[model samples]
Each structure stands twice: as structure tokens, then as C-alpha cells.
Target: MLLPRIIPVLLHTKEGLIKTENFSNPKYIGDPLNAVRIFNEKKVDELIFLDIEASKLKREPHYELIKKIASECNMPLTYGGGINSVSQIENIIKLGVEKISINSSAISTPELITQAADRFGRQSIVVTIDIKLSGLFRKSYKIFDHKTKTTSNIELLTHLKKIQELGAGEIVINSFDKDGTMLGYDYNLIDYIKPSIKVPLTALGGASKLSDMTNLFKKYGLIGAAAGSIFVFKGKYRAVLIQYPSNKEKKLLYSLPYFIS
Candidate 1:
């Protein structure tokens, strides 16, 4: 069986690397380059760097910063935020980014997904959907737009189908409600959308322990498991630290039951 990709997601801002809860209350952590260096030592499967303010502030990606991080990173890198054009995608690829993740742009101008896939190959494009649970019962999932900070009327399954049909090679679903809670993933959310997804899929938000990843794999099989708080914080106090699963733990995780070879 193919082992799942364990990724550390770093949120970047003008200050530096930061962590957020429920997509609010950003706390400064440390430098992006420093985080990359540590992840390199950990020999992580892949890394995702998201410029949290780029789209909200209406500015371009920090190419210089991204270039520096990419150059220092040993594992494959995926970058997102304020990516709206083919030229920007080309330049980011030139700077060594393995994949470009688009959220806001994919909503405003979905044609860009096809355009980018055509120019850079579908494997180079990743579409991220930020979802928030709503309704009086809190069971409904809606697409949350980071730029506007509002939920759209679009249906979650409809949007997923649209992007996949538009040539998105991979899809990442992030739970705004679960972001940084580390309570474990919203399994109901995954079960809701899993059947509709055909391409590679990744889940981010609310992963607190290695066992959470194992449970996800045991239930769903191979899929990317990305987390922020679990990788950056330690213990009940949430002390700042940078770490990933060691090779020994990873071997054990893959050997756990329910995975089909």
C-alpha cells in the first residue's frame, strides 16, 4: 500500500510564521526559513506554506520569501494565497514550488484552473476549499471565502465537482470550524465529501496526535493528512515546538490495520 503523505502546514504573515484558531487570533510563532530548516531535518513527506494575508490584503505572493523557503526546503512544497494568474503560477514554479494551491481565485475565476493545468500540467495545480459548518443544527457545510470572510451560497459538493472537472489535479478540504482546535478531524465532513472526490485528496485542520492520522488512514485508506497545531505545539499548554513523526513511528503507522494493499 502507498503510505500517506504527512505534511506540516505553515501559515506565513508579515510578522513571521503564525498559528490560528478557528481562522482567527493569529499568534506569532517564528521565522518561515527556520521552520523549513527544521522540517528538512525531520525529513517530512511534504510541506505547505500559506501566505495568510496575501489574498485578504490584495497583494501578490512574497516571491522573494517563497524563493528563499523553496530553496531551503528538501521536501516537495505547495504554496497558496493571492495566486490568480498563469504568469504568477509560472514564476512560482520557476522558483521551485512543486504545486500551486488556489482558493479565492478558484472561486472568482475557475477558468484559471484549466488555464494553469494546461500550461503547467494538472499535477501542478491544487485547489483548496475552506469549509465552515452552519445551520441551526450545525450540520451543514458551506464554502468559506478567506478574502471576504463570508460563506457563499455555493454547495460544497457542487464546488468540489466543478473544480475537479476544471482540471484540478488534487483537492484539499480545510475545516474553518476545526482549524487549530486539534480535536480530531470532522469525520462526518470527510464522509460527506469522500465519495464525490476522485483525484488525490488531503484533509487539514484539527489533528492533535499521530493516532488521529492513523485513525484517518484506517478508516479512509491512503490520503494526505496535513496539520498545523499538532506539529507546532507540544503538550496541554501548547508550547511552541517544531516536530514530525520519526521514521520508526511512521513505519508503525503504516503497518496498522484496515489498509488495503
Candidate 2:
């Protein structure tokens, strides 16, 4: 079995890196470049820097900041947010980003995925789905629209399959309900969406610790284990503490049996 890549998911705004709860209530964390420098020393497997405000503001990614982060980062980086065109993808690649994640744009214009994949190769394209479960039993998928600033009525699995068909190399399932809760990931959501696409899938949001990642990887066999709060904060108070598991801890995590009994 292929070991899943352990990734630190960092949120970006005009201010800098921040953490959020349920995708709202933003709390300032630290500088993005400072975080990158720390992660570089830790030798993290990969990094995900998402510009949370870019899509909502309908602006291109902060290219200068991204370039700075990429230049300082030693590990492979995956950037998402405000990417809506082929030129943006080309430029991000030129800046040394290993992958480009398209969320709102993927839902708004799926052909962008195909176009990007055709030009940059499917392996470089990652589609992110920010979904929420609502109503009785909390069992429906809600697609949040950055353009309309509302939840879209689009069906969940249909969009997942569409992203796959468009030739994305990977899919990142980010949970709106679980964002920053750090209770755990939405396992039911993963189980529901697993069979719909063939590409590697990564789970994001609500991962508070290493075991959460290990359990998800063991249960779903994901290609990437990504989290934000667990790496950026410490303790129940959510104090600012950017940390990553040491190399020894990561090795132990990957060696665990497929099923922990």
C-alpha cells in the first residue's frame, strides 16, 4: 500500500495565515512565510496553502506572496483559491508549485480543469470540494458558492464525477461542517464519495491530531492526509503553535496495521 502524504493545510488571507471555525470566525495565526520556513525545517511531506479570500474577493491569487512562499518552501506545495484560468495555472507552475487546486472555479466552469490538465498534465491539477451537510441527521451535501456567496443547489456526487471526468489528478474533500472543529473528519462523507472517482483523494478540515489522520488513512486508504488546526494551534484554547509530527512519529503512523483493533 502506498503511504499517504502528510500535509499541513494553511489558510491565507490578505493579512496572513489564519485559522477558522466552520469556515468562519477567522483568528489570526501567523505570517505565511514564517510558517513556510518552519515547515521547511520540519521536512513536511507536502504543504497546502489556500487563499481563503481570493475566490470570495474574485481576485487572482496573491502571486507575490505565493512566489515568496514557494521560494522559501523546501517541500512540494499545492496552492488553491482564485485560480480561474490557464494562464494562472501556468504562472503558478512557473513559480514552482507542484499542484494547483481549483474549487469555486471548478464548480463554476469545469472545463477549466480539462484545459489545465491538457496543458499542465492531469497530475498537476487538483479539484477541491467544500461541502456541508445540513438538515435532519445532517446528511445532505451543500455546495458553497463564492461568487453568489450562498450554498449552491448542485448535487454532490454529480459534481465529484464531473471533476474526475474533467481529468483532475486529485480531489480534496474539505468539509464545511468540520472546518476547524478539529473533532474529526467527516468519515461518512468520505465513504459516500470514495467510489465515485478514481483519482487520489485527500481529506481536509477538522483533523485535531495525528491519530485522526492515521485512522482516516487506515479506514479509507486516502492518498493524502491534510489538516489545518492540528498543525497550526496547540491545546483546547487553540493557542498559536505551528507544529508537525517528527519523522519518528510519521514512520510509526505509517507502520500501523490497516485495521487498528
Candidate 3:
């Protein structure tokens, strides 16, 4: 039986590794390399490192730093931020990275998605959509533009269908409101968006415990549990700690029924 992949979504700025609440107030956590080493030891399913400043500053991905991280990672690594061109995607893949996540570029210049997919194959290209709901009823999908520091009015389901047509291998649906909240995965958002796209989908933000992951997979079918705060912080005080599920914990998690219906 297929198992839902559990992934840790690590964020880094120019300063180093950090965490954020609702995509604001980034708090420094620890060294990126150190976290990768620990994840390697824990045998994580996969890892995602996103440079929060890359798109805001309009700079290329830090290839050297990515190379360093990829070298230490025992599992597949996916890197995002400032990835605007096909050449950059090729370079990142050359550094032993398995996937390249495109966000802002995918919105502004969507052709880059198709271009990169053609050059590197669709499986190597992932699109991450940061979303925020508008108004009390949450009727519309607001696409968060990190570079502009504003949200765009786009229909969530329509945008996702376009992404699939663009040949993206996977889709990461990130919640702008729930990021770093550690509340739980947004089940309503998953249900709303899942039927539109056929590709592998991953949910990030608001994942506080292993049971949250179990619940997501059991109901959602094949999906990825990508989290930040829960993996790095512990207890009420939220102390910084690098951790992952033990081998036994992982065995039980993967063994859960992946499809409920």
C-alpha cells in the first residue's frame, strides 16, 4: 500500500533558519546545516528548504548553500525561493536536489513552470501556492505575493487547474493564515482544492502533532504532511529542538489507512 509522505518544511532567510507566524514576524531558530544533519539521522522521508528572502530580493537560489545542504541530506531535498528561470532549476537539480518549488515566479511568469518542467521533467518541478481567505465567509482565494507583500484576487480552484495544465509534478497548498500557528491542517481547504487537481498535493502550516498527519492521510488519500513549527518547537514554551518521528513512530504512521473511501 502507498503511504503518505511526511516532510519537514524548513525556512531560511539571509540570517539563517527561522520560523514565522501567519507569514510575519520571522523568529530565528537554528542553523540550517545542523537541522539537515539531524533530519538525516532521523531518516526523514524528504526535506524542503525555502529561502524566504530569495523572491523578495529577486535573487537566484543560493546554489553553494543548497549544495552543502544536499550533501548532508540522506533523503531527497526540495529547494524554493528566487527560482525564476529554467537554468536555475537545472543547476539546483545538478546539486543532487530532487525537486524545485516555484511560487512567485509561477504566478508572474507561469511559462517558467512549463519551461522548467520540459527541461527537467514535470516530476522535478513543484508549485507552492500561498493562500489567504478573504472576508468572514472566506468566499474568494487570495494569492499571497511575497515580493509585492500583497495578496491577489484569484479563484483557488481555477488557479490550481491552471497549475496542473502547466505540467507541475506536485502542488504544495500553504496557508497564509495558519502558517506557524500549530493549530492543525486546514481540512476545509484540502476538501475544496483536492478535487480540482490530480497531482500529488502537500499541505503545510498548522500541523501540531503526529495525529494531525495521520488524520490528513486517512481522509485525504495520497498527500504529504509538510510542517515547520511542530517539528522544531516543543512544549508550551516552544523551545527550539530538531526532531522527527522515531522509527517505530514512523512505522505506525505509514501503516495507517491512506484512503478512507
Candidate 4:
């Protein structure tokens, strides 16, 4: 049986680490490099470093910092932000990173999904989608041009299908309304994407407790699940002390009948 995965998401504002609620108000956590060293010692399954400012500034990912991170950290590292081209993904893969994930760039340029997948192989490309709840009916909301705040998810079903056809290996469905709030994963995202794509999927945002995660395994057939807030903080207490469930807790969640069903 494949062991379920737990991942930590590190957000970067220029060069510092931060956290947020519903993707707004990113609070500085600490130096990202220092945090990586700590997670390295803790034996984390993987690390996701997303530079929130890279795309907004139209600058490439800070590869210099990435190289040091990949070298020092024992786990596989994946980095995103400002990734908009074929050569850029290739350049990052060459630097010892295991994968390259893209979101805003793929949204703006539809062809990037196919180009990156074809050049790097499907397994190396991860497509991340950031969504929010739109209206009283609780529909998924997609944002285009984060600067202008235009919103829609009407094109999402079609877009997800296109990326799957384009050879992308995995998808990460993130909820803008739930990030760092640690309430739980957006369960509806599973209903939204389950029918369109035949690829491994991971859900992030709103994962606050062990029951929240157990509910995810019970409700969704997602191949993997992730939470930055739950692994890094405690409920209402809101401390920076990092935590992960012991081996037994992981077994209970992974072996639940709902997970296999």
C-alpha cells in the first residue's frame, strides 16, 4: 500500500515566510531557509515553497535560494510562482528539484500546460488551482488577474479537461476562502473536478484537525491530501510550534475503509 503524504506549504513575501487567512493578510512566520532546515531535521515528507510575490513582480522564482534549499533539505522540494515558460520549468528541474508547479501562468496561457508536460514528462508538472466560494449557492469561484479581482469558475471544467489531455500528471485544488483558516479542505472541489480529470489530485486549505482530514479521506477519492496550517499550528492556540501525528494516527487515517472505497 502507498503511504499517504503530508506536505507543508511555505509562503514567501519577497524573501520572508508568511501565513494568511483566505489568502489575504499574509503574516510573516520566519526566514524560509531556516524553516527548511528545521523541517529537514523533522523528516517531513515534502516541502512546497510558493513565492507569492514572484508573479506579481513578474520575476522568475528565486532559484539561488531554491538551490540551497534543495541541497540542504533531505526531502523532495517543489517550488512555484512566476513560472510562465517552458525553459523556466526546465531550468528549475535541472537544479535538483523534483517537480515544478504552476497556477497563474497556466491560467493566463492555456498552452503552457501542454508545453511543460510534454517537455518535462507528465510527472514533473503539477497544475495548482486556487478557488473561492462565489455566491449564496456556494459555487466555486475562479479569479483571473488577481490585481483587478475579476472572478469566475465557468471556464474551470473545460480548463481542467484541457490540462489533463495535455499530459499533466497531478493537480492541486486550493481554496482561497479556506487557506490558513484551518477549518478543513474544500470538499466541493472534489465534486467539481472528480468527473473531468483522470489524474492524481491533492486538496489544500481549511484542514484544522485530525477529524477534518479523516473526513477528507471519507469523502474524497483524492490520491493525496495536504495541510500547511494543521501541520504547523494548533487550534485557536495559534502557535508556531510544528506538529505531525504519530505513526498510529497516520495508520488510522490511511486505513479507514472510506479511504480505499
RMSDs, each prediction? 2.3, 1.8, 2.2, 2.7
Model 2, 72-101: lDDT tens per residue?
999999999899999999999999999999
After superposing all C-alphas onto the true structure, candidate 4 shows an RMSD in angstroms of 2.7
What candidate 3 gets wrong by more than 4 Å, as runs, is 136-139, 255-261
Query: Where in model 1 is the C-alpha error above 4 Å?
Result: 258-261
Who is ahead in TM-score, 2 or 4? 2
Local distance difference test, each candidate: 0.91, 0.87, 0.87, 0.76
Regarding lDDT, does 1 or 2 come out ahead? 1
Tens digit per residue, CA lDDT, model 4, 68-150: 77787788887888899998888888888898888887767868888888888888888888776676676555644453455
Candidates 1 and 3 compared by lDDT, better number:
1
Clashing pairs in 4: 184-206
lDDT of 1 by residue, 1-261 (tens): 455899899999999999999999987889999999999999999999999899999999999999999999999999998898999999999999999999998889999999999999999999999999987865699999887888999999999999999999999999999999988887789889998999888999998777778767778753799999999999999899999999999988777764222
TM-score of each: 0.96, 0.95, 0.95, 0.90
Please, what are the lDDT tens digits per residue for candidate 3 over residues 11-75?
Answer: 99989999999898988899999999999989999999999899888787888999999999999
